[model samples]
Target: MTGVNFQFTRGKRNKANRTRSPATERVLTQLKMISQRRKQPKLLQVCQEDHIRHETITTAFKLYRQEINANRAKLLLKQYESIKYAMEDLEQINSYLFHEANTNQKGKRFDLEMRIPTEYPPNQIWLHDYTPAEVAEKK
Candidate 1:
């Protein structure tokens, strides 16, 4: 009623319990064997339940990996589209600049110094207390 409230309410979230990579899991699966020392063997129902749980975990990981891949593909597609549109707009605006941009460079490589943009703004906006080198340059 008075001011804005910023409160976070805890809620139950479905999270996986796996701590290992799927490849590692698969490799470990090959090394496992059913218990041989049988005073009493495990029940059929228990075995089935364990199998189901394994399948569920495998399915969940596969789904999660697929989701991640799809997101990456979507981001790449968006960037491609933006470039395509910008190029088209440039062509319409001026042919010379567009052709200059469209020139093929077979040996072009990505700049090592370029930084990828992040989802959130950085902690420091600009270097306000920065100073340039006072050393004089020889002609």
Candidate 2:
């Protein structure tokens, strides 16, 4: 007596062609769960950091305005204004940095170490070594 062997490949191909199958559903569900658990926390962190940086920059601007108003010397006023404008620019840069950091991207932090020029013929100032965190806390 000889035994007959039977194998089926057609069913496998048919299953592959079918949509809304159990395997596909399971895979999609797993992917969605993973994404929700991971990406959301990061986004939240970014948002918080952005808010903190914004508040800091705002404070810096207020202080700069006060300083500008207090000075009576003509040359000092001009220098104060230049520093103020440069600091405003620095604030914008910090916003960009915070955004970049939240996105897990690298960016230059604000530099407070550099002297903001007080007297120049063109009224220009250079900002260096400042980070968004530092710029925000600056008075």
Candidate 3:
């Protein structure tokens, strides 16, 4: 039987596609403030004095804003992590593909080429003599 990579997500759908963003914190803070203001009409009055719109001062608006912020934060965090991993992969490929060649002459040069995951093992093998473990350790 094949291995199951299924994840049981109860609260949030498509959570794996999401990332946390810096703005999420700010949105959550605003939602907190909105809930607090709802409990105290005096604070809401103060917001009105500050020229905050009535639509923004509502509980419904607060809920929508909170949801939007959460999604934004998730996307941002995901993007950041993806970029980070991509850079790491690039570094890995570079280290494996390019290296200083050893030469006996006063001046000598050599070329190196690499292809990633060319074929499945045991039929597929890396072009060079170095083992995968050795190449990884070198980097």
- CA lDDT scores, all candidates in order: 0.75, 0.67, 0.61
On lDDT, the leading prediction is: 1
Per-residue lDDT value at 95 in model 2? 75
Ranking by TM-score: 1, 3, 2
lDDT of 3 at 10: 61
Worst 10 residues of 2 by lDDT: 121-130
Local accuracy of candidate 2 as per-residue lDDT tens digits, 1-139: 3575444444554555555668887899899888874445444445878999989999999999888777656778799999778767766779775455446535554455444565554333444643566466675
> What tens-digit string does per-residue lDDT give for candidate 3 at 1-139?
4764554556653536434455875698788888874454454444554555555568678898999999999999999999778767766778543332212445232333333444565443456564454465578
**Estimated TM-score per prediction?**
0.43, 0.20, 0.28
Best by TM-score: 1
Q: Please list all clashing residue pairs in model 1, or write none if there are none.
A: none
Greater-TM-score candidate between 1 and 3: 1
Which run of 10 residues does model 1 get worst, by summed lDDT? 130-139
Better of 1 and 2 by lDDT: 1
Model 1's alpha-carbon lDDT is 0.75
